[model samples]
Target: MDPFDSSDDSDDDIFFRMMYHYYTTDLLQPDPTSLLTRCAMLNRNREEGHKHLYRDYFADNCVYGAKDFKRRFRLSRDVFLRIANALESRYKFFQLRYDARDRREFTTLQKCAAAIRLMAMGESPDTMDDYMRMSERTARESLYTLSRGVVEAFGDVYLRKPSSHALQELYVVHEERHGFPGMIGSIYCTH
Candidate 1:
C-alpha cells in the first residue's frame, strides 16, 4: 500500500491517528477557569502597598544622615547629589514626574540612591525594597537607567585613556614610590 494512503490499517497509522486525536480534542482546548483566573490576577493590585521606608530610613535623620551617608552610599551626600543632578539632567527617565492621576512619582534622588546602593553593595534588587520602598522591578529598572545615565554623563572624563601629562605624572609617582624609573604600574593576576 502507498505510505500516504488512508486505507492502510497498520500499527504505525493507528498510533499516529490516536496521538493526533488526543492532541486536537484534549491538549488544544483552553481551560476557562485558568483564563479567568489569569485575568483576575492581572487586574488585582499585586504590588505591595506604599511604605515609608525610604523616608524613614534615608530622608529622616537616621543612620543615613550627613555623617554616615558616605559610609552607606560609598559617596558623600554632596557628591551623590551632584551625580544625581547630572543623571537627571541628561536622562529624562531619571527625572521625576507626576502620574496621570497627579500622583507624584519617585524622585531622582531615590532612584539614584537605590541604583548606587545596588551597585556598591552588589545586592539584589529585592534587598532594596525594604529600604528604598521600591518594587524589585522598579529597582532593577532604576539601576539599569541610572547606570546608563552615569556612563553617558561621566564616562568620557573618568574612562578615557590617560593623557601624556597624566601618564608622566603617574610614572613620576610610581618611580618615587617604587624606585623604578620607567615602570608605570604593576598588574597582578590571581587564580
Candidate 2:
C-alpha cells in the first residue's frame, strides 16, 4: 500500500485514528498522534466542510494539526456497533466464550481486543479491516476501548481467559524476544 492513497477516501482515516490509543495501551509503544496523521491525510484542496475535531478541541493534546482545524473526522459509537456485530458473526463470537451472558452488549472495546490480538501477531491491517468489514480506525478504536468502563470489562470478572492460552504463548515469546521474564505478561507471573 502506498500509505498515501487516501484517494479512495474510504474512511480508513477513522480507523487509523485508533493507532492513537493502540500504541498507548497495555504499556505498548505510544500511538499518541494518529489523529494528527489522519488530519494530514485529508485533502484540503479536494474535500470541503471537514472540521478537524481533535485539532479544534484538543490542540494542546495533538501535534499534527494543532493550529489547522480544516478537516473533520470522527468514528461514532453506532458505526463501531455494526462493525462489531459483523465481526462477531464471521468469527462466530459467542459471548459465552467470553463468559458474558448478554451477547447483545458486546462493545467496541471487546471488538478491538480481538483486532489487536489479530493484527499485533502480524496480520495485516488491510486484511483485518476487510474481514471486520470496517475501516482500519474502526479496528483500532474497537480495540482501544479507552474508557475505564471498557477496560474493566477486560478484567477477570467480565471475561475469563480463553482455555487455549494463546496469549500465554505470546507472552512467553515476548519474554524470549526481550531477553527478560517481565514482558511475557503479568498474567503468567506474580510480578
Candidate 3:
C-alpha cells in the first residue's frame, strides 16, 4: 500500500516510475534554444553576391530584363514588388537588417524572390544558391517565412472560398462551355 515502495507490480507503480524517470531524465536536459538561435543567424556576408545576382543580372535590362525576370521569377516585377512590400510591412522577419557585425543582411527583395522561385519552380533549395546567391538554409528559411507571411497577410483575399455570386458565375460559364448545368468541374479518378 506504500506509494514509494517499488516492490509492487501494480499499474499505478509502473505509471509513477515512468513519470519519475521522464521528469528526472528528459525534463532536466539543458535548453537548446540558444544553440538553435545561434545557428539561425543569417549569413550577411553574401550581400555583395546577392546584389550581383539580383541587381546586376535579374533586374538589368541588358541581361535578363523584364521578360526574363517574369519568366524566371514567375511574377512581373511590379507584382513581385507589391508582394514583397506587403510581406515587409506585415512581417518584421522579412525586413532587412544589420547583423551584430554591422553587415547588411539579405534584402526583402532577395528573400521574396527566393521564396517565390522555390514555390513556383518546385526546385530543391540547394539549387537556389548558385543563382540566388543565398545559402540553402537561408533559402529554406526565406520560403518558410514568406509562405507563412503571405498566408497571414493575404490569405483572406486570395485563399477564401468563392462567394455565392462567384460560384453562380462559374457554374454558368462551365454550363455554357461543357453543356452540363450541374457539373462544377471535372475530376479524374485513378485506381
Candidate 4:
C-alpha cells in the first residue's frame, strides 16, 4: 500500500483510498435504488436480499430498532447512511447554536422520510407516530431539524448548494373529482 504505487492500482483503488483518508467511518453504503422500478440490478428479492445484506455488508454497526421493519418498509444500508448525513448537515446550525449533541440514530433517516409523508398526508407528529410506530418525540424532532437557516448558522455558507442540473418543465393536471389539495404540483415531483 505504498503512496507511490501507481503502477498496479486502478482508479477505484485510488478513489477509495482518498475517500478513506477523510471518512474514518467504515460505512460504505449499499446502492440506493428507486421504489417504483423493479429492475434486476436494483430489486433484490426480499428473502435472499435481506439475508445477504445482513451478512457482512454493514460496517459492524447499522441496525435500526424497528420491529417488523422487514414487513413495514424497505431501505438499504446506503440510503440509511445518506439520510443520516443529510439530516446532520441539514440541522448542523441548530445543533451547534444551542450546543446540542446529535441523536444520530439509524431511525433518523426513517424519521425524515416519515416526516415528509406525514406533512404530505396532513398528519401531525403524534398522529404520524401511531401509523409509523415511531415515538412522538422522534418524529417531531426530525421535522424541526429540516431548516434552511440552521444549516447556515452552522457556517455552511449556503443552506442548499446550487446545482448544475438543467431545469426541466413539468405538466400536471387536476380535476374536481379529486379531494382537497388535489391541485398541487411539484417541479421536482419527488413527493
Candidate 5:
C-alpha cells in the first residue's frame, strides 16, 4: 500500500528503484565524449571489394595477368594466393564470417590484399577504402593480422637467416646477375 515501499509490486516503487540504481551505477560512469557524437556504421561494400580483387587478380579470366599482378603487388599471384590461403586456414579472423547483423564480412582475399597493398605501396590504412571498400581501421587490422600470419606460417622458410651454402649460392647468383664478383648487398657501383 506504500508508494515508496518496494515490498509491494507497484510501478512507483519499481521506478524509484530503477532511478536509484541508475544514479548509483550508470550516472557515476564517465561519459567518454562531451558532444553527443556516436560513430555510425559505414556501408563499405566489402563484397564488391572482394569481387573487384578477384576479377583483377584472382579469377581465371581475371582482367590483370600474372605480370601485372606481380608488378602492382610486388609478388607473383601464385605466391600471394599461397600466403592468403595459408592465413585463412590458420587464423580464424581471416576466415569468412558474418556479423551480429547477419551481414557478411570481408573475404580472405580482400583482407590479404588490403594488408599487402599497405605493405607494398607504403600507403596509409584509409587509402584502401577507395579500392578495397574497407574502413581504415579494418585495413590497419588486416595489415597486422597478415604480418603475424605470414611470420607464423612461413617464418622458417622465408624469414630465417641464410645458411653458409645458401649464402655462397646467393653471392654467386648476385655476381652473375649484376656482374659484381663479390657483391653482398644492392650496391650498384662502388666507383
Candidate 6:
C-alpha cells in the first residue's frame, strides 16, 4: 500500500472501477416499455370547467361580483383581465387550442386562474386539478408560463429598478410608516 508504488491501482482507477460496477451490476435500469406507460387520462370535461369559471367570475350576472373576485384574487377583476389579456396576446401558450383528438383544451382564463391561485393562495399544483380541470403537470406549467409571460410582457414597468428620487421617497415613506429611519428593507433576516 505504498503511495508511490506503481503496483497498486490508483485512486482514479479505483473510483472508475466502483462506478463501472455500480452501473453494470448494482443499478436497476428501467424498461423502455415502462417508460412509455403513462397515467390513465381522465375526462375532466375542461369545456365545462371553462363555462363554470366564466359564469362564476367573468360573465354578466355572474355568481360572484367584483368585490368577491378582488378578495379572492388579491387583484380587481379588471386588472386580472388586463394581465390575462396581455399574456394571451403576447404568449401563444395562453391561447386556446385543440388537442390531436380535437378535444378543446383549457381556456386562457383557466390557465391564468391556476397560476394566480398558486401565487395568491400559495397552493400546490395538485390543488388546481379539481378546480381548473387541469392535470398537476398542466397546472405547474401554467404557473411557470404565466410567470415568464408576465415578466416578458410587463417587466419594464412593474419590475424596473427604482430611480434615486423614487428610492429616497421610499426611504422617507418607510421611516414615516415604521418609525425606522432610512430602513428600506431587511438585509438577511426576513419576517
Clash counts for all predictions: 0, 12, 0, 0, 0, 0
Which ten contiguous residues of candidate 1 have the minimum total lDDT?
Answer: 41-50
Over the stretch 13-132, how does candidate 1's per-residue lDDT look in tens digits?
977877777776678788877776633222111122223434434555553577667777788877788898998888877887876656666777778888999998889998875656
Each prediction's Cα lDDT score?
0.72, 0.43, 0.78, 0.46, 0.87, 0.86
Indicate the residue-level lDDT of 189 in model 3.
16
Instruction: Please report the candidate that would top TM-score against the real structure.
Output: 5
Better of 4 and 5 by lDDT: 5
* Tens-place lDDT digits, model 2, residues 15-123: 5755555655585744678635634332222011112322333336654452232222133334334444445544433122422332232333334433544444555
- C-alpha lDDT of residue 46 in model 6: 98
* TM-score ranking from best candidate downward: 5, 6, 3, 1, 4, 2
Candidate 5 C-alpha lDDT tens digits along 51-73: 88889888889899999988888
Question: Which wins on TM-score, candidate 2 or candidate 4?
Answer: 4
Question: Candidate 6 clash total?
Answer: 0
lDDT of 3 by residue, 59-123 (tens): 54446677777887788878888889999998887888887878777888888888898998898
> What lDDT is reached at residue 80 by model 6?
92
Error of 4 at 167 (Å): 5.8
| Residue 82, candidate 1: C-alpha displacement in angstroms | 1.3
The candidate that wins on lDDT is: 5
Kindly list the per-residue Cα lDDT of model 4 for residues 57-138, writing each as its tens digit. 3425535433333223354445445545666565642232311233223234445555554554556777643344455665
Instruction: Give the clash total for candidate 4.
Output: 0
Off by over 4 Å in 3: 1-45, 56-62, 168-184, 188-191
By TM-score, how accurate is candidate 6? 0.71
Using all chains and alpha carbons, the TM-scores for the candidates as numbered come to 0.60, 0.23, 0.63, 0.30, 0.76, 0.71
RMSD of each candidate?
Answer: 10.9, 21.7, 9.4, 23.1, 14.9, 8.7
Query: Model 1 off-target regions past 4 Å?
Result: 1-67, 170-185, 189-191
Give the Å error, residue 34, model 1.
6.9
Compared with the true structure, what per-residue lDDT tens digits does model 6 show for residues 99-159?
A: 9889998899999998998999899999887878888989999999999988988899989
- Give the clashing residue pairs of candidate 6, or none: none
